[model samples]
Target: MTKEEAPVLLEVRGLAAKAGSAQILKGIDFTVRAGEVHAIMGPNGSGKSTLSKVLAGHPAYEVTAGTARFDGQDLLAMAAEDRARAGFFLSFQYPVEVPGVANAQFLRLAYNSIQGARGRDELDPLEFDDYVREKMKLLEMAPAFLDRSLNTGFSGGEKKRNEILQMALLEPRLAFLDETDSGLDIDALRVVANGVNTLRNDDNAVVLVTHYQRLLNYIVPDYVHVMDGGRLVKTGGKELAIELEARGYDWIQKSAA
Candidate 1:
């Protein structure tokens, strides 16, 4: 089926949000259908990241107006953990470092929690070990990573890979990845991008929040959106990203003016 024919995974209309007293998202309308990759691109403080945080039900942001429906249900009304249980996943740009938790333990608990919520059988430690290791291989991550503290002392690349590994294990229906390409070397970028690509299928969708077109070269988004002044100003095909790279965002600002 074509993208337009696919089922709508997320729909937003007049989405306005704020962090504390500052309004971020301003009257945004967006949609995502299954089997598509969408890239939200903009300069610093354009609300690209804020959009994802709001959809994921982050506590810091308040939805002042508009509606967000995920899989035909009220998204803003659901709790953050409930959003995850309903197949909504958001990868943080900065993966937090949990000092005492082993990476494997963290992954297993998260996987089992979601599984139980879905009424699927929860895997025990041994069962989950085998399952997660297979997922880790997709990211080319070493087994040693499972034993280390979650994101603690991990290099930038390792942390990103760990985040993707979580995505692989949970297999979210809709993933909102925030600045996933930041601070990665070339090799790491390819590995992480490859992992994301491998996880893609006609049954799911990915929404990427990024600043540069370089990530698009690997992920190949079906649609590219440019945001400015807390609103989505323009949207085009993958080639729009190429234009942004060459000409800069100045024209976008002028055109929207």
Candidate 2:
């Protein structure tokens, strides 16, 4: 058929989560097929980030109920690192800074770890340098970026670009980007969006979690899912994002009601 009709990469059903006593992600059901880009938008406290973290298998939240399958494997059963090795990636909303780790060193370690997990020989430092630099070119990052401590002293746009670089190098099958557009200017947004678009293919999928539709303008999604009251209230095409931009999320809650 078509790339748009590619097989499923992620299937999440009846997903419920809780952070200690607080209930979040009451019941999230979504499907991400290979070659599809899905955007999840909602207001604050709506559990968008929570769902991303839960799927990534973060220890802070417990999966009280439900199931997720990544390429036919039980996703919830895998550890966070295993999830990454299994081609599941989550880009944090707040990419943290590492004080002592060189960016190149960190990226190489992460890349090699995934390769080792997949039963492949790790790339030597010299080999990885050439490989990583090629991926950096996709984000227009400078060679000096590899020398700095990871994310330390990086501008907001720089950190986001660094995250995209990780996504590019690892080449995960499914990626969940949380608020990647936050704190980015128009030009940076376009660059980051273009980098993500370049990585799109019939074997991977992207789920973007954001609060604004501005990013959607750069990276158009095949589906837009509205989140409210800890669940998905609506699903539509790219036009849904424009509608939310014009009318705000209240319009979705009202429409869902």
- The candidate maximizing TM-score is 1
RMSD of each: 0.7, 1.1
Please give the range of 10 consecutive residues that has the lowest summed lDDT in model 2. 1-10
lDDT string, candidate 2, 78-181, tens digits: 98999999999998888989999999999999999999988888998899999999999999999999999999999999999999999998889999999999
Per-candidate local distance difference test: 0.94, 0.93
Q: What residue pairs are clashing in model 1? A: none
* TM-score, per-candidate, Cα-based: 0.99, 0.97
Q: Per-residue lDDT tens digits of candidate 1, residues 29-137?
A: 9999999999999999999989999999999999999999999999999999999999999988999999999999999999998999999999989999999999989
Q: 52 in model 1: Cα distance from truth in Å? A: 0.8
